[model samples]
Target: MLQSLTGVEKHNIEKKQAKALFESTLWSDAQTIGVTISRGFEWDTKHIIESGWEQGKQMVVPKCNPEEKSMQFYRLNDFQQLETVYFGLQEPKPSATEAVSPDQIDLLLVPGLLFNTNGYRLGFGGGYYDRFLANFKGNTIMVASQQQKCESIPVEAFDRPVQYVLTEEGMKQSK
Candidate 1:
């Protein structure tokens, strides 16, 4: 459904979702945030990254190691610190950025293709986020458009539910 959105429609929805997130206490209270640089079909996170910088909050992006099926986050001070990697994903250049411990992140913005009200998500199938969440102690949240919401998703033993889901309509604590 996300792929069907026109550029204008996606942009407007993304802006609204971002605005809702900004108004949430989670956004206001988090000092350090972890997020991914979005791809074309995903909700754009560039604004969120910039807003974190403008608010004096530390922003971090992940670099995935395909071999280990793991991810490490790095502090991203500027977009110039990123390099295009596999599948055209923008990842933090290890040489240009400082590594940030998972414990230091107050909130993590989880990515998903689809989600239910319960917070269970249908991720991109890499399981990187699932593995990372296994030990992560910080708050987890997912931002999606209303179109991305579904009645349910297939859950596995390893699946982890996010604490909250923010959409263009508003933010809701997952059941």
Candidate 2:
């Protein structure tokens, strides 16, 4: 299992490679999706926005309040319209961020500290996403560098499973 954070240079390279795979496979048919901001130490997701743009699909991002342990997702209809919010992550207008109704989204690209092909993941010791995903109705996919893959990740009872895992190597569905 890979531990510690990946360096910026290596992370960027892996992110680019994984993004390329994501673009070639799903971008062509996906019409709507949600991605998360690449906070420090998190996987980069700017390419999801670019891929969404190329496909003319609607892209959404999440605004999270660690204090409240809650999240609001917004459609990235226009990048210029986004404004920086808490923790330097971009969020749509107040009205743009809305509660995610189950299954309302077609896809959700997730980022995590560690994961395995079976969909098990270890987050940053926070239950925020694990809880938020309890009700999400969509195909959750994990995007991370090859180095993030682990032989096994502790599975809590409340953990949510992903539909697939995307890495620099290619795509692998959770088994």
- Summed backbone clashes in each candidate are 0, 1
Give the TM-scores of the predictions, in the order they appear.
Answer: 0.97, 0.79
Q: After superposition, how far is residue 76 of candidate 2 from its true place, in Å?
A: 1.2
Model 1 lDDT-worst window of ten: 145-154
Indicate which candidate wins on lDDT.
1
> What is the RMSD of candidate 1?
0.8
Which whole-number lDDT from 0 to 100 does residue 87 have in model 1? 92
- Residue-level lDDT for 106 in candidate 1: 97
Best by TM-score: 1
Q: Whole-model lDDT for model 2 versus the true structure?
A: 0.72
In candidate 2, what are the lDDT values of residues 1-175, reduced to their tens digit? 3336458665665667665656655545566788876765566567668767776787777777778887777777666757787557676676644455535667788778888878878876667678778888677778777778887678879999787888777777899
User: Residue 107: error of model 1 in Å?
Assistant: 0.6
